[model samples]
Target: MEKLEEQIAHLTRTVEDLSDVVARQDQEIALLTRRVALLLEREASREAEGTGGVVLGDERPPHY
Candidate 1:
């Protein structure tokens, strides 16, 4: 029937739109995941090198 065909077409378009949205979100999540991994690696390296320090409210900078 024509109505059934219209319904199918509408559903197909909706699915395609959702798929595009999911693909974009997947890419964004992947990028954020990589950034987090890099930051964690850098933090681990700094800690391992024994150069990690704390910042106090009222203290001289580390370079002082």
Candidate 2:
């Protein structure tokens, strides 16, 4: 009976640890989803303004 109790305790602890890991991952995924949505909105607004081309560092403008 004592051996059975020990096994049950270990299994419970393992399950709790896994639950914590899953909760943390869920929060991270939610944050990333929000950031992606914001970026898409910003890109859409830029396109609407007719500035679709992005100028990189030391890059010449299209008119140059």
Candidate 3:
């Protein structure tokens, strides 16, 4: 029937739209994951070097 065909078409369009959204979300999540990994690696390297780059509020500036 025509009504059944119309319903099928509508459902198909909805599924396709949802699929596109999911694909885009997957890409964004992948990019963010990579960025987090790189940041962690950089922090680890800095810590391993044992540089006192961290300063406290009470500490005077090295320029002084």
Clashing residue pairs in candidate 1 (N, C-alpha, C atoms within 3 angstroms): none
What candidate 1 gets wrong by more than 4 Å, as runs, is 56-64
lDDT of 2: 0.96
lDDT of 2 by residue, 1-64 (tens): 9999999999999999999999999999999999999999999998999887878999988788
The Cα local distance difference test for each model comes to: 0.95, 0.96, 0.94
Report the C-alpha lDDT of model 1 over 1-64, residue by residue, as the tens digit. 9999999999999999999999999999999999999999998999999877778889999688
lDDT of 3 by residue, 1-64 (tens): 9999999999999999999999999999999999999998988889999862889999998899
- List the candidates' TM-scores in order: 0.78, 0.81, 0.75
CA displacement after TM-score superposition, residue 8 of candidate 3 (Å): 0.8
Ranking by lDDT: 2, 1, 3
The most accurate candidate by TM-score is 2
How many clashes does each candidate structure show, in the order listed?
Answer: 0, 0, 0
